[model samples]
Target: MIVFQQRYPVAFTIAACLVCGSAVAQSAIEHHVWQDKRKFEPYSRTAKSITGAIRLSGNPDFATPGSKMTMTFGNGKKVGLTSVGASWRQWDETDDKKATAEAFKLSRDPGHLRNGNTLCGDPQSDPAQYVVFLERSTFGDSTRLLGMAVFGSKEVPHDINSQSLCGTFSYSTD
Candidate 1:
């Protein structure tokens, strides 16, 4: 899995600057950069663990049954997503079955929202969100949505950020 911080070092900095304003983002960048000159990794805590089905927003073809998506996130402040086209068939049925079962079980929980997690609804409290796009869509050459998930507090963490916030995400295309 591609670690978001390692892959896109400046992505969050730019995004933070755009959403929260240059002052806040710059301050954060400066603080983090000052702390660690090698890289700017913002620390955050796992306030909640939310899991549910997520759609690839505007890309339907990549979200189809035969397509594949693998997501991974860790202490860093971003979600790592890797997608495979529909034609590339080499998926593990066992993993899919487990993920499907978990999704079903979570669906019965009342705490979760109707559409799974409420990351999009509350971005201020938890700013660490992730959106993925297929570099090459199955139907065309342009980038397309793969999927996305969010779960983390914006407040700086006093301890090590080693916990998994949102647990695991699962869904079925059938």
Candidate 2:
């Protein structure tokens, strides 16, 4: 007959193995978004006011996290060739989470290229930064986002930041 001196160790080992197995079995799916193209006539008075609409889609695998995910812009066409004043917000699924900061700038050159950085609060409430790239397609009348990549930390602070892409943005000059 086999005798067991301690059952607690055996039970703990079994529980640990089950937890680790469940974690290994669960794989995270990549999320994505594509904004519908729209036309924007350059604002005329040093900064012309333009208006347009865009369709935002979430990747099939992930759910749209919230209703308030959006982007906003401030003053533009400043300092000869820079759009200096721009601010955007990316909302999360919960109100307890603060919106991600979308601070970006655009080149005044003919291409009107865009480059910027965004920061989001992590689960630990630390700020994580991401690089953004945007450009207007010369072949088409629409604008395209080249890409955005987040780095510097293994763990993303915000849940929305974990998605392949957080939000699709549409803009107008006002």
Candidate 3:
């Protein structure tokens, strides 16, 4: 029989392997909207708001022991633009976004979204999006995300389980 330490070089190796396996076998994405804001009239003084959170369970095959498993957003293909911003580029990549929390604050700033007249198109309509990234690693790093906890700007009850009228959410597994 092999000793416990001798059997498993790293105490958490088994747990980490199991976690990575689960992600590979059944990866999933859950986007929960906690707040949302929109406006049909750009010139309007105020705008509707929507906020939400996203959870991802992904497994990147062939990842090394010390490699990283980060969740990054794809760049826009059309117009040769690669970015996750609300600009003149097509809206393809604008839908699926991920970035550091600090980057998302640019949109959540009350004053920024309030300036609806600076819309890309359709002066009568304005849309804004704010998404934050959550990273996981194969090196036994864990992120304790208990679903998304978005705060509603309205005075309504803080029903975390309730869905908001935010953008569409899609879930897929590999």
lDDT of 3 by residue, 20-49 (tens): 888888545332221112111111111112
Question: Scored by CA lDDT, what does every candidate get?
Answer: 0.27, 0.29, 0.24
Winner on TM-score between 1 and 2 is 2
The candidate maximizing lDDT is 2
Q: List residue ranges in candidate 1 displaced over 4 A.
A: 1-54, 58-112, 115-117, 120-122, 131-164
Q: For candidate 2, lDDT tens digit of each residue in 1-174?
A: 123325466777787799999988966653223222222233222113221122222113222222112222222212111111212233332223343222222121111212332223231333333222222122254543322222224333233354433232323322
Candidate 1 local lDDT, 55-142, one digit each (tens): 2212223334333223222222222232222222212221221110000001011233433444334444434332222111113533
Please rank every candidate by lDDT, starting with the best.
Answer: 2, 1, 3
TM-scores for every candidate against the unseen true structure: 0.21, 0.22, 0.18
TM-score of 1: 0.21
lDDT of 1 at 130: 29
Q: Report the poorest 10 consecutive residues by lDDT, candidate 2.
A: 77-86
Which candidate, 2 or 3, has the higher lDDT?
A: 2
Report the C-alpha displacement of residue 174, candidate 2, in angstroms: 23
